[model samples]
Target: MDKIQRNERLSVIIKTLCDNPNKVFTLGYFSEMFGSAKSTISEDLDLLQKTFKKNSMGNICTIAGASGGVKYIPSVSEMDVRETLEELAKELSHPDRILSGGFLYMLDIIYNPKWVNKVAMIFATKFSGLGIDCVITVETKGIPIAFATAQYLNVPLVIVRHNNEATDGASVNINYASGSAKKIQTMVLPMKSLKRNSKILFIDDFMKAGGTSKGIIELANQFDSKVVGIGVMIETGLPVKKLVGNYHSLMKLNTSEMQENNSIDIKPNI
Candidate 1:
């Protein structure tokens, strides 16, 4: 292959990360991608991170202290998303790796007790003075993030399931169009999860079309609860008419161009 220009290489790497967040990468991988040395990649990341801040975009954080790697999280100015994704992109970029299915394969990060604890701390810090009474999340994938947020905030977590079942006992269900699934699905949140007149924060792993988010807001209204904020690990840059007016996103997705120009579009929007 021909020599890769520094600016072109940086653009490609950022795009790759936007395509897949919460993925970790090794230094050796970067060396090969850019045909540069480890030290050079490190310097490039530092410069890019500074650029992010200067541009009011976001952060590209480094994780050290054993089992460490680089991660690009979507936090900071451009958008508010968790910061663990930059590292994830590094790992997923390896030529030999295989990631099939619709799954994000984030079990390793989600199951890491230490990381989860730290994440909780971060969320708590953000919501500490926000007067939050409860945390809300959709069923399945979002449970972990929501639980962590609730734990740190010292509030209860309200789960909204996609389908109502006997296991849920009784719930308030609403139908809305899901952006990721691209279909109308019923979202159910138990009636007993929140107190009447409670203040709430919505937390989810990903926000696409925000159909599920809208459903959760409706459920909160049924119990006389008010939504104060919304938090997510990733936010696909689509219309947000379905989401609450005030919210936080860790990362924003730029599906407009996938690898053609800037694939990942990893920028932080507060």
Candidate 2:
């Protein structure tokens, strides 16, 4: 076999690490693949780490010990976070994006791969230190972002549903009051969805009064899990207090003004 060049090895290494964030890749594995010495691979990783840090392109973390190797830790710099949120606020502030019920039309943003991946990176970066076991969200709109976050965090994604599915087997159901509408809503999670004593991270597209987040907390309790972190793409401003505390939101939406004036008044919360 022809020997792989240094540049070729570096490119493949960066691609692999970025593609599978937070996943450990043993040095022996890479050494065997590249037909190179472990010391050579370590030097390459050092170069990549310095480049990533200098360019603000996340991190390449090297794990020590016999079972350790390297992994990508996705992160957004403060300047980048502010810039992204500002751009999002601008895009969502357009009058056409405002819906009838004082809700900002952000389905397109949350569903778009470009935006979804970026926002998910922000969420994953914020909660990266939590030792999160899984990322959880309700069914429907929040799935995309939640899934992306789970990918970055290198954990499973758990989805709670409004109704139980026959295919889900036995499930645990809980009713919690909606923070915005003040109406009761049912949340369903399968019994086998989570293991006991797991730490969960909740990700959602929007938060009115954090009813959904609160519901997620209650549901996590059923499985003997705890919600260690909560992250939402956008949160309303009216509710000075939310049902759940200690959440990170990228953007703040002024629903009242948006409803009254038919214009968006949103800003970055970072």
Candidate 3:
């Protein structure tokens, strides 16, 4: 076999790290894979680490020990995040997207892979350091965002069902008022989806009165897991008081002016 040149090894190593972010790979693995010496692999990793930092591509953490290895973390700059969200806010603020009862139509953006990936990047950057066990979301529109986040964070995803289904056996259900509508609704989670005390991050497409988030909090409790953080794509401004506390939103929507003026108030959370 031809010896792998430094440039060739570097490219493959970067791809490997990016593909498996947050997963540790020892120098031994790389040495064997590329038929290189430990010293050479170490040098390559060092250069990759510097490149990641210089380009703001994220981080390559080095752990030293018998079981030590390198772990990749994906990140985006604050400036990039601000610019992206500002643009997204404008697109979502269109008057035609407004629905009855002050809710903005977010299905389009959430379903949009390009937009949702950016939203996921924002959340993943915010919560990546939290050592999250999994990314969890309630069923429906939030699935895409949560899945993307889980992908970047290199963690598993757990999706809660809005209704208990026969397919998912032994589910834990909870009742909470639907946001803004003030209608009581039930949501469910399966027993096998989570382990006790698992640190989870709850993500969603929107948060009005924070009812769904609150209910998600309770649902997580049934599994004895803790929600370390909560993130939403958009939140309502009218019902200023939210049932849940200490959460993050990508944008705040002011619905009052939407109907009459065909205008919207979108506040950037970045």
Candidate 4:
């Protein structure tokens, strides 16, 4: 086979690393693929790392030791994070987005792939170092965001639902009160969904009193697992204290303004 050009090697290497975030690829693997020496592959990786850092395009990390290699860690720069969240807040702050029940209509933003991927990048960047085994979320709206986060983290996505289906097989169920409405609700998860003692990260679209997050913690306990982190796209400013204390929210929505003035007061939490 003809020798692969340096530019060709770099292109393929960068694409492979970015496509499979957080997955290690040994230099030998790339060296064999390119029919190049390991030292040559290592030099290529060094150049790629510098390029990524210069462009603020996440990270290309090299791991040492026999079992180690290289992996991509998806991240966004602080400036990009701020700009993305601010743009989202502006879109969500439109008065027309206020529903009769004082709820903001954000389906368009959350469901849009452009915005979802950007938000997910923020979540993944913040929690990537936590050694998370899986990304978990409740059914429906949070699914997209959680799924994207799982993709960026290169981990499995575990979804918790309100009701169990026969296809779910045997399951575990728990009842918890809603933080805002104070209504009792049931959460269901399949027995085989999560492995025991796994480290979990809960990702959601919104948080009010954080009852849902608290419930997730309780559910994690049932599987003998632990919730290492909790991340929400938006959280209410009211009730100041949440059912759960520790969590990271991208934006803060002022509940009083939305209810009384019919105006939105949302801003980036960062």
How much is 144 displaced in model 4, in angstroms? 0.6
| Cα lDDT tens digits for candidate 1, 114-231 | 5555445456556655788888877677778778767655577877777777766667877877656778788777666668998988887777777676777777788988887877
Candidate 3 lDDT, 52-77, residue by residue in tens: 89988889888999999888988889
- Candidate 3 has a TM-score of 0.94
- lDDT, candidate 4, residue 83? 93
RMSD of each: 15.8, 1.6, 1.9, 1.4
lDDT of each: 0.64, 0.91, 0.88, 0.95
**Per-model TM values vs. the true structure:** 0.58, 0.96, 0.94, 0.97
Model 2: per-residue lDDT, tens digit, 1-270?
224588899999999999899999999988999889999999999999999999999999999999999999999998989899999888988889877787677788888999999999989889998899999999899999999999999999999999989999999999999998999999999898889999999999989998999899988888888999999988888798998889988888888898788888899995
Q: Is candidate 2 or candidate 4 better by lDDT?
A: 4
> Which pairs of residues collide in model 2?
none
How do the residues 58-157 of candidate 4 rate in per-residue lDDT, one tens digit apiece? 9999999898789999999999999999888888988899999888999998898999999999999999999999999998999999999999999999
Maximum-TM-score candidate: 4
User: Where is the poorest 10-residue window by lDDT in model 3?
Assistant: 1-10
Clashing pairs for predicted structure model 4, backbone only: none
**Full ranking by lDDT:** 4, 2, 3, 1
